[model samples]
Target chain A: MAHLAMATGFLLILIGAWGALTNRNLLRMIVAFTIADTGVNLVIIAVGYMRGRTAPIIDGAVSAADAVTRIIDPVPQALVLTAIVIGVGVTALMLAYTYRLFEKKRSLDIRDYTDLKG
Target chain B: MIKRFIALALVVAVGSVFATLLFGYTPDADLNLTARYYAERTAADLGAANIVTAIVVTYRGLDTLGEVTVLFLSASIVGLVLAKGTHAPHRTPVPVGELLTTGTRFLVPLILLLGVYVFVNGHLTPGGGFQGGAIIASGILLLLLADPLKHFSHSLISAIESLAGIFYVMIGLAGLFLAGGFLDNRILPLGTLGNLASAGAIPLIYSLIGLKVGAEFASILAALSETEEL
Candidate 1:
């Protein structure tokens, strides 16, 4: 099941990449890039999950020994969470730049905003 | 049309054959021993039940530090780009909806509290400093959007960010001086496993990270929202 989820995520990422590269609208491209980035993060987190494991906690129902035995790996979850937050930050910055670009160029089309032709 | 269809089919067939030959599926072996070893060692040395947090904040703290620096650098670049002799957006002075303004005024404190709680209890639970810090920044963003008239204090945010960043570096260097390695956890007492105070230097480092991230994000939002000409 996890493998299937990872495969789906990879598929999404590829599609997103295609959309980002081929899309004419700058906003749509940014959205596609975000989708691709999120798909990658999802694939990473999915890889950390196991078939039938509890959360990594040693509480009343589960002893430390049992916790060790039943829990899926949590390291990837933590790392992915961090990556997701950073992704949000980057996306926000990208949106801000997009806004600025739109304001200056007065258009959302990528081809229209090309001022750096040399 | 027939020739194009034949070429497409041939390409697909060849790609599939190549994929099957190059990347045949292999059954993965269960590595119970390695998992057990890591679990036991993490529980013993890290003193945090959440091995993920332990590994991120302690065992691989240097990496986390670098990650935080990356965030800082990105924020800096954003600020620099936006600051380049640009005028702020024309202030139309559009009246904010009273519902949003009042609702966000009520929500800000609660969100801030929740963010702090998440950061402080990171070692014991699923959430950590970076997540919590970003949450706090989101709250600030909400406030900024809802109440355009209200503004964050720039000097305070800058001071806090710089101080937090410098303090983080100083802490890592102190660890290097005391424990002979940057970001070593030996400086603080590694208390019992699963305790809040356990994981020496981890919580402190994460707290610094949270502070830095929060301030940097808030400032980035502020810079973007500024209506004044640069």
Candidate 2:
């Protein structure tokens, strides 16, 4: 089931890549990029999940032996969180630049804004 | 049309071959234990349950500091680009909706609270400084969108950012004196595990990161909003 979710996430990333590549609208392209980035983060978090494993928290009643068996891996969760933040930063920066580009060109289409085209 | 078709076919064929090769290969049985070892040691020595937080803010704090510097640099470049050349005269104000303004007025505080919560619980949960900082940045962006007239005090944001940057470096240097390595966690007393006071230097460093990222992002958003400039 987890593998299926991961595969679906990967599929979404591919679809997002396609959307980004084919789309001429700058806003749509940015949205596609965000979708791909989110898909990557989802895949990472899914990889960290283990069947029947509990969250990595220590309980007072749980014995030391039980703790080892029940705790899920938390590294990927941390990594995903980090990746999500980085994605936000990049997305925001991209949007800002896109806005600036739109301001100068008065259009959101990428092909129309090429002043340096030879 | 023929050239485009050939290029598409080549891309599909190469992608399929790579996917097939990846599927055929099995990863090694040995688990990547290095991160785990660092996590466990951090949890024990620093008394933090969220091993990931300890690793990010303590064991690998230098990297986080560098990441913040990169963000700062990016924001500087964006600001420079947005601020270049003479300002355009008599620019028309972009019309904003009342709904967005009213809605964001209520939402901004909640979003800021959640960002703080995420960072505060970082030592015990999945989130840490960077995630929470970015959340705070989004809140600032919301404010910027909702109220373009309400300008952010750039001086205040710059002061906070500069202070945080200096403090981060100072903390790393202090670690050298206390623990013989930059960003060493032994400088502060590691409290009991699962407690708020745990993770010696992790929370401190994370807090600094949060401040730095928040300020940097707010400045970037502000710079981006100015259409009359550049």
Candidate 3:
């Protein structure tokens, strides 16, 4: 299950990279970048997965005494949570930048912004 | 054509790296040193039922603070860059449909409530500040969708954001003075392992984080939605 999820994540990353690299539209590139972000998060989460362990939360089901053996790695989960939030902020910033660029160039094409600006 | 080929080549190279890592990857049969320590010590040290929350809110709290700062900076830049473009549309927008309008009216408050619940229970549950904040912003998104021209009060949003941020830092400072170090959750008594009020300052800190993050995201959404449709 872990391998399957990790593979899927890697595929998404590749697809996102491909789309971002080839796409001329700024909006599409942003979308592609977000897809890549999601992929990265997925990979990290999958990496933290242990075969038969549950989540890092200690409830009646998993006692703190045995949590070390029964839980998946919590560090990656924490790291990914931060990454996901940062991803949202980044996507918003990208959208804002794209909106400003369109306002300036009156176009969304990458080639349109290629000319040097003062 | 050449650009596409080069892009594909670069992608393939990256893909090979991922593939190699995947193939070489061997899942650890046991928790590593860091994970082991967190598992063993989190409940006793911070009393957070959710070990991930313990790690995020206390063990490595400075990183979370920096993450919040980065988010705040991005939100501010988005608002600043899009400010001039947010004038009301010159034309009337179509009615957003009865179901959406009515549903939003009925659901927005509930959604906001759920967001509060998630963050308030951060120490004992799977959800936390970021998830809760995103949930709240999603409610705001629903509102915008229902009424395209609806304006959120920028001052109110910024006030909530600033107050949450200020109080968050203040709590951290209080921890510094009273507890072991900055952002220590132990400044408040660790009630119990699974109670709502168990994790000392974690619930409070997470609630502040939730409010701050929600306000920032709402501002970003509002700014994006208010832009004149060119």
Candidate 4:
């Protein structure tokens, strides 16, 4: 299951990167970046997954003393939580830039706004 | 055709590297030293049933603080970018159906309640502030869809955002003075491990985080919605 998730995440990243690189529309590229961010989150979460192990939550089912053996790593979960939020923030920032770009250029195509191109 | 071939080649190259990494990876049979320390000591130290909450709000609290700041910055930049211009394009008022409006009014409170529940139980459950905040923002999005022309009070949203952020910082500082370290969970008495009141300041911090995140996201959404096409 972990391997499958890892593979899926890698595939998503590849597809997203391709779309972002090749797509002409700024909004489409932003969408592609969001997809890539989701893929990165998935990859990070999957890296910590253990077979037949439960979550890191210490409850009745998983005792505190034996949690090291029973529970998956909590570090990755914590890191990924922050990563996901940060990803959303970045995507929003990029979208804001996109809005500004559109307002200035009056066009959504990236090729149309090459004022600084040498 | 050549572009498609090159793209496929690039995908294959990148995919192969990940595949190699995946093949080399092996799940640990036992937790690493740091994870083991957290797992064993979290309940005793913080009295939080969920170790992830302990780690997020206490152990790795600084990183979470930085993450929240990043979100706040992004939302502010978005608001700045979409600020009303000298020549604001007028929007046509579209009437929403009564059924949709009534349904949104009925559902918004329940969604908000669910978001509150999720964050409040951060120390005892899988969900936390980030998830709950997203849920609350989705509820706001629904409201926006139901009544497109209705204005959400920017002042109210900013007030909640800033207040939550200030309270979070104050709580962190209080922990620095009263507890083992910064953002320590021991500032408040830890009730029973599985109880709602348990985990000391975890619930409080999570609630503040939830409110701030929800407000930031809603502000971003409102800014985008207010943008007029040129």
Best by TM-score: 3
Instruction: After the best TM-score superposition of candidate 2, give how far the Cα of residue B152 lies from its true spot, in angstroms.
Output: 0.7
Minimal lDDT window, size 10, model 2 chain B: B22-31
Clash-forming residue pairs, model 2: none
Score chain A of model 2 by TM-score against the reference chain A.
0.89
Model 2 per-residue lDDT tens digits across residues B140-217: 989878866556777898999999899889989999998859988778887877777776777787778888888888
In candidate 1, how many Å is residue B146 off? 2.0
Sorted by TM-score (best first), the order is 3, 4, 1, 2
Candidate number that wins on TM-score, 3 or 4: 3
Clashing pairs in 3: none
Model 4's TM-score against the true structure: 0.95
Q: lDDT (0-100) at residue A10 of candidate 3? A: 96
TM-score of chain A of each: 0.91, 0.89, 0.96, 0.96
lDDT of 1 by residue, B1-230 (tens): 56546655654564465345334533223315545555556666656666667767766777777777777777777777676554445656567788978989899999899888888777777777787888899899889879665567878998988998898888888888887488776688889766788877777777877788888888888877773532
- iRMSD, all candidates: 5.6, 4.1, 0.7, 1.5
| lDDT of model 4 at position A42 | 88
lDDT for each residue of candidate 4 in B34-67, tens digit (9 for 90 to 100): 9889999999899999999899999899888889
For model 1, name the residue pairs that clash: none
Sliding window of 10 residues with minimal summed lDDT for model 3 chain B? B83-92
Compute each candidate's TM-score over C-alphas: 0.84, 0.82, 0.98, 0.95
lDDT of 3 by residue, A43-65 (tens): 99999999999999999989999
Model 3 spans with C-alpha error above 4 angstroms: none
For candidate 3, give the docking quality class from DockQ: high
Which sections of candidate 2 miss by over 4 Å? A57-68, A103-108, A112-118, B1-31, B85-107
